[model samples]
Target: MKFRSSLCLRRTAAALAALSIAGSAFAFADDDARRAILDLRETVKAIQADLSVSKNAQMQLMTEINRLKEQNRHLTGQVEELYNALEMEKRSTRDLFGSLDSRVEAFEPQTVVINGESVTVDPKEKQAFDEAVLHLQDRQYKQAENGFKRFAAEWPKSPYRPDALFWWGTAAFALEHYKTVISTQNQLLREYPKNPRAADAMLLVGSAQAASGNLKAARATFQKVQKTYPDSEAAVTAKARLASLGK
Candidate 1:
């Protein structure tokens, strides 16, 4: 009975030792599981923090994009306004230049026809000649005479000189200044023998001599006109005058 009791004690001691070892192993396994769960929770918290930061950064980026968009819209409006202003300036400049060119053209030299001949004259020169012709056309004989005389003296090289001399003699004859008429018409015939008005000047000279009671010289001049310019109107008029004066 004492040996059986000792055997029982040894079996009980072995079972107690095995049970303690199993409990220690189970405790260590539980601690390892808890640590693993804690590590996973920390990883989850860190990911959440990173996600929050990223969300905030994304929001900031969206705000910046909107701000840049607003700035671009404002700049586009300003650019359009500047382009319109530039166009207006260009139009105004073109108009100003056009006006200036017109004024300059008015003062510039012009080509005109005088006495069936094309000639270039300054505006002032043409104006002066036109005014003298106007005086003659108005039958202001004294003024016409003076104007033509002045034109001859002032513009001796003018293409209008021959016409002016003829008109001067015409004015003098209208006023009964026969000597002046004779002298002026003689000058025109002498200077411009091939002039368009040469036959007319010769006829006028003959008329002046006849009016001053020099019929012999008048008849001679009229005969000369028929001989010199047979196809002219002055030649036809000369024939009529010769018939009136008899032979």
Candidate 2:
């Protein structure tokens, strides 16, 4: 009976030691699990922070790109406006130059008709002739005579020669220069016989001769005029003059 009691006591002590070791192992495992859970939570928080920072950076970059695009569009519109303004200025300049050119051309000399014939006269020539004729119209006899003489000498081949000679003779007669009248009238008759002023020139010569006290010569000229231009107005005047001269 004592041996059985001793064996039962030894078995009880062994079971109590096994129970204490199992309790220590279970405590250590629980501490390890808590540490692992804490480490996982810290790692998740770091990952979330990194993602937020990346999102912010991406948004900033997108905003910058959009701003650059808007600025580019504004600059493009400004460039186009400048180009259009330049084009309009160029067109206006061209139009102004064209108008100026046309105005300049208008002052140039051109062909015109004189005495039923087409002729090209210089601008200066026309102006000078008109001024000389204006002097005659103003009864400036001396100036008309001098101007007509100069015109005859300078423009001998001009279509105005016949008219100039006729007016020169008339001016001379007005100034009582009978010798110059006769000479000028003779020149008109000799040079431009087919001119419409030829008969008038002959009549002027006869009148100048009569004024110069050459009655015989004057009567002969009047008779010649009546013979040469039988149906002309000068012939009728010559007939009246001859009748007055008692021839």
Candidate 3:
């Protein structure tokens, strides 16, 4: 009986040891599964962060593209406006000269005297004036300058004297003889202040002074346009230029 009881106790001890080994294996499996789950969660979080960064970069790029497109559109609109303005100016200039041409043809007049008595002439003084005008129309600047100069020298006190002086200045400006341009334009402004050409002469003086690198003189001339001929075209142009120069 004692030996049988001892064998029974030994079998019981073996069964307890097997149960403890099975419980340890189960715990290790649980821990490995938990570790795998945690790793997967960390991988998912990292992927989401990368995706967020990519989305933000794409959005910023799109915003910058839209801003650049808007600036380009504004610049294009400004360019179009400038082109339209230039075209209108060209059309207006053409129409003005066309009307002047027609009027000149319709009102061709005869000779008129200033101080001298009437002299027999085959062609009127108007014919000489027309010839000078034709030279100007043909862009024969030197010939036009000479013709107008001769007209002024011969008919010093003639009614057409101021017009001749104005044309002479214009021709000299076209020839890039800025000194002569300033001299002729100054003569008109100083000597014939009430003449219609005087206002235009002031503008020519400013232009000549500016071209000759005399900014102070140009500003003075432009200031005179504002003070003396405030409503004239020269004054309007001077205001714009002065504003551009921060004056």
TM-score of each: 0.59, 0.56, 0.50
- Could you give candidate 3's per-residue lDDT for residues 170-193 as a string of tens digits? 988889889999999888877899
User: Model 2: runs farther than 4 Å from truth?
Assistant: 1-109
What is the Cα root-mean-square deviation between model 3 and the actual structure? 21.7
> Backbone collision count in every prediction?
0, 0, 0
Q: TM-score rank, highest first? A: 1, 2, 3
Query: After superposing candidate 3, which stretches have Cα over 4 Å from the reference?
Result: 1-124
What count of clashes does model 1 give? Answer: 0
Q: What local lDDT score does residue 135 receive in model 1, on the 0 to 100 scale?
A: 91
- How many residue pairs of model 2 clash at the backbone? 0
Residue range 88-201, candidate 1, lDDT tens digits = 999999999999987887799889887787998777677777888999999999999999999989888888889899999999999999999999989998899999999999
Inter-residue clash pairs, candidate 3 = none
The pairs that clash in candidate 1 are none
Q: Residue 214 deviation, candidate 3, in Å?
A: 1.0
* Residue ranges of candidate 1 with Cα displaced over 4 Å: 1-107
Q: After superposition, how far is residue 210 of candidate 3 from its true place, in Å?
A: 0.5
